[model samples]
Target: MNLLIQLTDLSIKTKQLELLQPLSFKLYQDKPVTILGQTGSGKSLLAQAIVGLLPSELSQQGQVEVFGQTHDRKSLISLWGREVIMLPQEPWRALDPLMPAYQQVSEVYQCLHDLDEESAFYRALKDLERVGLKSSALKRPGQLSGGMAQRLAVTSATAGGAKLVLADEPTKGLDVSRRDDIIQVLMNSAQGGGLLTITHDIEVARQIGGDIIVMKEGVVVEQGSAQQILNHPQHAYTQLLIAADPRHWKARDYPMIEKKPVLEAKRLAIGRNGLALSNGINFTIHSGEVVGVVGDSGCGKSTLGDTLLGLLKPIEGSVKRLSEEAKPYQWLKLFQDPPAALTCSVTLGVLLEDLVKLHQIERQRVAILMSKLNLAPELLERRSTEVSGGELQRFAILRAMLLEPVFLFADEPTSRLDPIIAKEVIELLVDLAKEQGCALLFVSHDPYLIEKRCDTVLRL
Candidate 1:
């Protein structure tokens, strides 16, 4: 096999700390290398280091050679799009919110491949068609679902026909069917090129079926072939990671079923921008019950939640607030992407302090909730952008739970988390909602997770 990238004792460091331990590996043509680890484990930093996109505040040690030649940060810039492409962790963030889906892909062709506008458009259209996105050619990123956005991001990133593709959590929030479709796209794109993937999803690593590197807190815990590592993992952490998959979770038994109706939707028809996606939906959510909403991407799962929360108007029917005692502040939502929900302008501590003061919430309750959410005290010192996704998500939960919400809409809250942490967060949400007699409307793409945790499943 022809070698693509060779890392010799590659490590990342901040001024005061080492983020990634000295690691060595070789990526070859046609073979994908997947790094499996939890959030804050330096998996993303490693990808950044390879692509010469590490933050200026951080420094690196050791050597990195791509395509048999060593290149520094400056030299590597010349290779971007033409020879190297890095698909970011958040597909929505990577895509231009205002640009049409086909235009985004066509732009890559026009700029990197030196094609005329007409030719680029034609090629981009064909590419989208191949990925099952031809029907969404005119739609913008905001209009598409999570899975469609992911596919578009990949198609646009690879349109330049780069030889080395580094994808960071490409399948983070997608359903099983869409996830497999993306995997197939990546595999096809890497037919003769090199693909390096960074993911927390063990199934992604297993499906890629190549070399697997497991990292924890910047340290490489284990590395081997996918079959050997996944099926016969020798490291304790690896075993723990494999065992954390929701498919292996024991079925939970929820006993307390309160009769108090918190929210009821009758003949609800939900949609966005005057477009109806689902109609005649009827359900009554009782206090302390976990109701899961499951459907394929773009089937109106999130729209349903927003309509019930009164964030969006229902096209038809009505959502009744059965609990007259509950205040507007008692209704809340936990977003799928924590960064979007939080502001980067303020430190987490400041946000928490403001919330406490505005609500006159007791200091003891804040401390207790923080402890229960497993949020570190120092995390409060940093801005939302300064923390990892998992930590930031816990902070979101801590903020919401502090309000003592009577009704909570959790929209795929743990979709980006590692299985181990995802399970913990799910349990915490379930237990806390039960304790407070709160009603939960949870949306998830993972059928296994919904099956094990939810009391009732709402198929859209």
Candidate 2:
């Protein structure tokens, strides 16, 4: 039970915001430590600081000791890839999109061992299979689903031979059934070595069944075994989080309203490279209805949404616009991981403005959309890298709204949003879709969200 990671008086600060303030904790070898916090509370920042991936603009103070050795900026830089590895929140960006999935994991193995590419490739494939991914997924990140991408990231980090693995919101966007599978993979990694999982989901922490540290505003509010803290949460924040669990949605009854069909998929078959991911799928979304599609990881829920949006061409059947006279409503697709979709080294405002200009929409209308989406007008000038995941997701949706498509396809739109904000976004989308007669197709694995907002459910 020797300490593998120790943080004493750790503080991280940006120009306007303090991420973590006077944080301290110790993580032992072969044990899992879950760091809990609300969004923008520095959970991910702490992970980044530990793995030397924190942005340069964020100044740090205090000691980060790994393997009983103190790590400063220099030591941390030297320790990365050997002693520590990070499974970032956005797995799509975490891996090089250009590299094949097998190569992505193999590269890590190659960096850590003396094995040739052939051996490393096989080892990577084994790791993927262990995480429930098929051997064929080793070809590309774009070809994988949200859950598969996450599994690939976890396998890559685990195969890297790092003594301490840092996973940020590892199961954030997974469906309930898949969440357990991903958690098991992370816990297995800890059993194999050590792990520090930073997450907002209490269920995830409980599943890990390890030491737990609750954080708020960059501070450790509670620390103890998962059994003690989760069962008898001492802090108000912890209790609030537990109460806010999305799983509670099953108990609440939502208003039911009759509406006309706005979008229809008639035996649709979606594929890429002559491979069908979604075959013979049929579903319909009404003007006010939010139809949710749920399935296991890589089960083609996202592929179905992509096909509905005309982003992916169907191979056999067609997705028809049933509402012929429906108003030209805007369709906004919030990605499962926003950073991957919003990155360009450009300011958030510039991207929005460009979209507005491309659509020949008035700038004033763009400002209004941003306000409706709860984004700061000033964020226009801020670089995409400067914003949080929730903000970026909302911003992307706002940008999409400017186009005014009649059908809206939201793919895990609230994946990065806090529970409260996630609820707000869901409500807003439903209201907007109903008010404007827009057909909405929302794809998520979270059954709770579907139960709350959807008029119909489709199991992929």
Which candidate comes out best when scored by lDDT?
1
> What is the per-residue lDDT of model 1 for residues 1-460, given as tens digits with 9 covering 90 to 100?
9999999999998889989999999999988999998888999999998989999999999999999999899988988988999999988878999999999999998998889999999999999998778988999998898888999999999888889999999998888877888888888888899999999888899999989999999999999999999999999999899888888789977666655998999999999989898999999999998999988777899899899889999999999999998879989999998988999999999999999999999999988998998888999999998997778888998999889888999999999888888888898889888888889999998888889998899999
Candidate 2 residue spans exceeding 4 A from truth: 14-18, 54-58, 250-258, 327-334, 337-388, 395-406
lDDT of 2 by residue, 192-238 (tens): 56889888887888888788988877778898999999899999988
lDDT (Cα atoms) of all candidates against the true structure: 0.91, 0.77
Worst 10 residues of 2 by lDDT: 248-257
What lDDT, from 0 to 1, does candidate 1 have?
Answer: 0.91
Best by TM-score: 1
